[model samples]
Target: MSRGPKKRTLEVEEIISLYKKGESTTRIAELANVSSRYINKLLLKHNVERRPRGHWKRKYHFNEDYFKTWSGTMAYILGLFTADGFISQQGQTVSIAQKEKDILEEIKRELKTTQPLYRNKSTGVYMLYMHSKKMKDDLMNLHGLNPCKSNNVEFPYVPQEYLHHFVRGYFDGDGSINFKGYTIVFVGGSYLFMDTLQRILNDKLNIDTNLVTDKTNYRLFLSGRKTIQVFAQWIYKDKNLFLERKYLEFMKEKTPLDLLEDRKFRNTKNAVKLRKQKFLEQLTKTNCIEKASSLIGITTNTSKQWLENDSDLKEKVNILLNNNK
Candidate 1:
């Protein structure tokens, strides 16, 4: 027998409505002009489960139109999503889980979703899941993502400038670091997915790595201290969000402007000029640009580009060609 101010039937229904809709007791009480304790009693009397401390503050839904944009944050989240996100075939539900809640927190913030991160009691994995047909359709129609995406997922198109953010997000999701062995590795189920990623990375970063079959899945490994260090610098460049523990693991051996000297020496004007001189010397010896480029371990297109871009090189090459004739 709870003895309190007896509310009208309408008010009680409205209070229940608010409670069901995730309104906090204090807020509901304030809205209803009732005491917090009275609101709690009312909710309990009606058999509504009490939320945990601060749980009511969580938004149970996400921004439905979040995946429609192409920002860096969106790209990164998409990358993370591509790595570990799952789509349920039964409905328009998508979920991403992580061992570290920090990355999930970052994803939530980026998606502008306050959706509660639920933890599995058995596996201890924190997952942020949402049910939105529009979002799921966008993911499928726009990115070609589907249910049971583990084995057949394809690499989605990412803009060139946001490539690092995307790959960093993917790394945070599916990549690992071997501190003692000095290796950076990425695991994936599809061979094409791994191969496409490898080609992009190799073309862009000049990273030499091994792409091999790892039992069922495939792995791309960038081994050795120099390769891993360069990769860390490349991926972590101007990054705002990443798995902090992984970032810290890479940071343990890094210095301020770690690759400054290497970049300086390699990018010096004198170095380019000297290289051009060496190419011209090779051109004089070989006569054919392709042959000369091969002799100097440069590409024929590079030799052609240098000749096109440098008038001095063009004149010297003409002189060498006339001599060869």
Candidate 2:
């Protein structure tokens, strides 16, 4: 008589290693060249406390079919979800957390759901959650995100047109901009995710970024006045989709300032150059350096110095003045 299939053998270390790395049962099965049922059996044998099926409460519900359409709001939420949302293994609940209550409120409004927002008093974190498999599946199917996603979460397949909005949402969730030096940084625990974001930045916006890894996570940063300015405008194309405080911080970065003796401004070199050209255009209409200086709120001496130092400006101003006369 032919013997039944040979007894399947599994190495304890191999199973434990994959599970510790946050691999799902399905993923572990693929890697181990075994069935998902076998992987579950090993977990049971090891007494691993697997994730529960559903959330504790079931007071509210939502029609997450709204997530099917591709809109800026949806794209933004997708980014936010990828950054902070988690789907339960039961596929019945999707949860997101942040420190901003208004963002939670905004998410409720966007999904048109009646789910109540929760706050952790000890941690000061605000949460918005729902019991909807549709939402979870939408995220997984449309965006390639899965349940129990944390450190190993990969970047989603955002549409080419909505990439900016998607990244903006991600930034609003996990990014920080420094007012002191105007540095833009995005922090996450996934090296793969950061690497994909860096590639998108270069491909979509032509922005070059540096990828630095700390002990726990990765940090993607853009430095210098020019790169920061470009990235700021690129991410915040839709102001309504972002956190108010973060948007205000960006506004502070975008605000124009008076010219300094060193020809400095709170902007990149290109922006400063553009402003100076505009100032000269206004001066051209006046036909006099003193009047132009007055129009720009700069002293006549400054204008004279600029004219002496910048031959291009001098030539353009002279031509305009002659034509006006």
**What lDDT, from 0 to 1, does candidate 2 have?**
0.71
At residue 244, candidate 1 shows an lDDT of 88
lDDT of 2 by residue, 1-325 (tens): 9966534334666566545534456545643557778888888898876755432344455667966888888889888888877676643667788999888888888887787665544567776766666777888887788875668888877787788888988998888876445567798988889999998888866756766665677877665455566777787776557888877766775444222121245568786477568678777675655444544434455567878888898888888878887
**lDDT tens per residue, model 1, 1-325:** 8888755323677678656756556555654556779888888898987788655353476688888888777877888888988776654567788999988987888777776776655467787777677889989989878886788888887778888888998999999986654667798998878889999888987867666664688877775556667788877888878888888777776555444322222658898788788888877776666545544444456677988998988998898889888
lDDT for 308 in candidate 1 is 93
lDDT of 1: 0.75
Instruction: Return the TM-score for candidate 2, rounded to 2 decimals.
Output: 0.60
lDDT of 2 at 9: 38
What CA RMSD would candidate 1 show?
Answer: 20.5
Judged by lDDT, which candidate is best? 1
Candidate of highest TM-score:
1
